[model samples]
Target: MSERREHAEPFPDGSHGDLRADCERCFALCCVAPAFAASADFAIDKPAGQACPNLRQDFRCGIHRDLRKRGFSGCTVFDCFGAGQKVSQVTFGGQDWRRAPRTAKQMFEVFAVMRQLHELLWYLSEALTLQPARPLHGELRLALDEIERLTLDSPGALLGLNLAAHRQGVSDLLLRVSELVRAEVRGSKKDRKKDRRGADLIGADLRGADLRGANLRGAYLIGADLRGADLRLADLIGADFRNADLRGADLTGSIFLIQSQLDAAKGDAGTRLPPSLTHPAHWSPGDRKVGPVVGA
Candidate 1:
């Protein structure tokens, strides 16, 4: 299945959202602008300005179907958060970097900036949908609008933007939202002191643990055994899920969980997911647990 589902209705009112990647309308900026190192994730080392070896004249990956077999599994997990298309069509006025050599450097620079802004938009959009965060909805909407405005700025203005400062402010707001929502989980006595933002959790045996409303932002959960873990309403914004075992886990109401994160992790068909997320094509089939929202 494609990473982006067309006209995906993610809003509470069942309206369609525009924060999805439409590759057909893009200039394949992600294939050209980002650098990749020679590792298990990528077959070759590519410098920042150089195009990937697998990138074709039409800007499609030469081995898209067999990316994992060819050691390019990293590509499967990477999501530009629709920034590639926004930068290609809006910021650069539909002009391609290869066709317009003079604007190539500037286009790449602006693309990096736009990617960060789009990620912020993704988080802000999700935060607005949470009922418990109603108090901060006005502030969240304002931040989303301000970030959207910055994405429309000229290449020079985008390059000069202090994105780190903006991200810090947004992160703070999201942390507060997490507290408001997770606090309301009935019968959930999960430890509040265990909230670790960006902690190294490699190979953690947290199977069957109750992680409801936990702030696991940026936690390194690579290879963590999380089978049957209750992750309802947890804030997993920037969690590193590579190789994490999520078989039979119920993540129905998890916040800030995205397709890219799922793609990086390991799971089975039985792994319960939110309505907005699709099961990864690589998962094994089994009778997994479904979240509380379903069949309630």
Candidate 2:
């Protein structure tokens, strides 16, 4: 099989672009934290908290040479926001979690927290690109400050975060940002159409949100709880869902989004499977496998 080449368009000239390559610094946390089922992309089943078969002892992909051929397409989409390396080199100071079994659980928890915090940074960085959100720039800057402070917290403090409250705060601000950006992107003349460009929706609890056919082009959705989200026909071009929960999210007709984005978003059995995702048999998460994307 021919190797697929997917070049990432970094957010360009900022912390976002700089953070794009940070995954290598950590423990490959995304691969171990998520679960998966057998599909065209994977040859077996794997579950959360278990190391993927494709993962090597050196913290590299064993099948990097043929990830697609080996049925692990989902692996292609994860972006750790440099948390993997931060947790590995900086947080744990190059100590292997496997060797320090006493701290393994802590390591996992820290990994999870750092991942969320990093995801928030991704959105804040993107929000800078949205020229229309100029009015809210002050507010966005404040929010970014709050999130950045959280990133510097100790592992113990990070694990103890009041994530619910934090999410609520971020969600409210993101909604305002979204509305403002949407107004400019859609313009006053366009009918009451959906417009969600550059919204800082990180960690927004959008469970069962009605976004069907809504225009979410270039929206920053990192770490948003999209459980049971209605993404049907939603124009999701350039939307960033890194670390966002997409369990039960219907993305049937959403255009311009790619499997790489989905790979970063968290999904579970309750998560509605997109046809484009191939379930890998190496996935120990569950027995069920995801079918193919019909349109593609």
Candidate 3:
């Protein structure tokens, strides 16, 4: 007997809404613009604005099979959410660095900007699908509209912007969305953060948790609710924050958290940030002032 019970989608977010893993439309933009250092995540040294040596004429990885052995785990982690292709085809109108040498640098800049905006859109779009966040559905829709507009701008316009403020605004709206969604997930509870050093909290409701100065070393925190949690002065060394909701967590004073963990967390506007991470234009922490957006 075949089990035909009511079936639900195995993947919740619709595979990033069909954007990631679709690099054919892109002209391998990420492989060109972002530089990589020879680390566990990269096989070679690449410059920020230069094309990767491994990028072939057809824009495919040359040593793709041996990527892990060669040390490019970081490259594998980056997903463009179809923004690469959109910028390459729609924004730039099929122009490429190989063909239009004069427009190469400008094209690369547009790709970078569109990638960030599209990433925001992907998350917002996912937020729209969550049932409990209905209270903030209207806000999510508005954010999605704004984010999509930015994503579809002409290449020239995208390159001319310093959207740190724009990101901040969107992040603010996203925080409210997360809170509403959390209500159904956690009920009417403080959901305080706990030290619980070695607890088996596979799917704990840690929203608004006060985990400041806590030690979560080697903790398995996958898919945990870290929204609005105070993680200041916390030690998160070796913690697995993969797919965790850090929408509004404060990690400004957190200790021992390298870039790898931050990159894994799903953070938004309410997330009190560290200088190591990108900041919105409006937030000017103690001594470090944000400089102009672009570089010549």
Candidate 4:
């Protein structure tokens, strides 16, 4: 998952500090590198490699305060995991696409590769922090270090990377970590059925369900009613939570839960989250009735 630009309190040791996006250090790579279709998420159809019309000369979104209202909700949830800044300042040596039009195409290509590599770094960094996954920490660290080095490769080298194969290797390791961590939660043999990996739960009414230790990786949970659900120790990697109702849900110990997922869902102040995550500003301070789930 990409990094969000929201202001969050840094980890005490600041180990994952660079994993978060620093828009000020970036040259608006996200606005120019990716193609955007006119959809519920984006207000306009934008071709790849072209800067969004809303992008300002200072590299800030012109509708920053009213992106959603202006039909650019998609822009608000995108997080490059610091890839924009890394590509702008490190890969290209602080040269922006506008300043070096000849290199703009190559820069956009490298940004794609760099973003995925940085995402792996984010997941690996989080895996190391899970005490239950201590046995795999050494492997995770080595992988993280390797990917971190790859992010520093020259643009040509970055573009040549076998990203799919590399991502699969790292994904296999993360699955192992997920299993190790989820094993800590004692559950009845019947509860083993909670292995809903890649389950199609779209628009399902799952209010107050006991999802503890559930393997929900890649589950399509769009528009699901997850209010007051116990998601502690759940493996939520890649779970589609768009429009999911999380009001009063307990996710404090949920594994692999990221901010982008929360940003897309509806939550209230009563939603309990991991210490590493912050509540989305759009979440209501108190409980509000959620509308009926709309089909994807």
Judge candidate 2 at residue 293 and give its lDDT.
40
Model 1, residue 119: C-alpha shift (Å): 0.5
Q: What root-mean-square deviation over C-alphas does model 2 reach?
A: 10.8
Error of 1 at 128 (Å): 0.8
Cα RMSD (Å) per model?
Answer: 2.6, 10.8, 14.7, 5.2
What value does the lDDT take at residue 283 in candidate 3?
26
The lowest-lDDT stretch of 10 consecutive residues in candidate 1 is 1-10
Q: Give TM per candidate.
A: 0.92, 0.63, 0.62, 0.93
lDDT tens digits, residues 56-133, model 4? 998887778888788777777787878888998999999988888999999999999998998899889888878889
Report every candidate's CA lDDT: 0.81, 0.64, 0.63, 0.84
lDDT of 2 by residue, 220-276 (tens): 898899888877655565688777887767765444455457665677554544443
- Which 10 successive residues of model 2 have the least lDDT summed? 1-10
The weakest ten consecutive residues by lDDT in model 3 span: 1-10
The runs of at least 3 residues in candidate 3 whose Cα sits more than 4 Å from the true structure, single-residue gaps closed, are: 1-18, 185-190, 194-296
Judging by TM-score against the true structure, name the best candidate. 4
How many residue pairs clash in each candidate at the backbone level?
A: 1, 36, 4, 1
Q: What is the lDDT of candidate 2?
A: 0.64
Q: Write the per-residue lDDT of candidate 1 for residues 38-72, one digit (tens) a residue.
A: 99878889899788888888878788888888888
- Candidate 3: residue 37 lDDT (0-100): 89
- Positional deviation of residue 157's Cα in model 1 after best superposition, in angstroms: 0.5
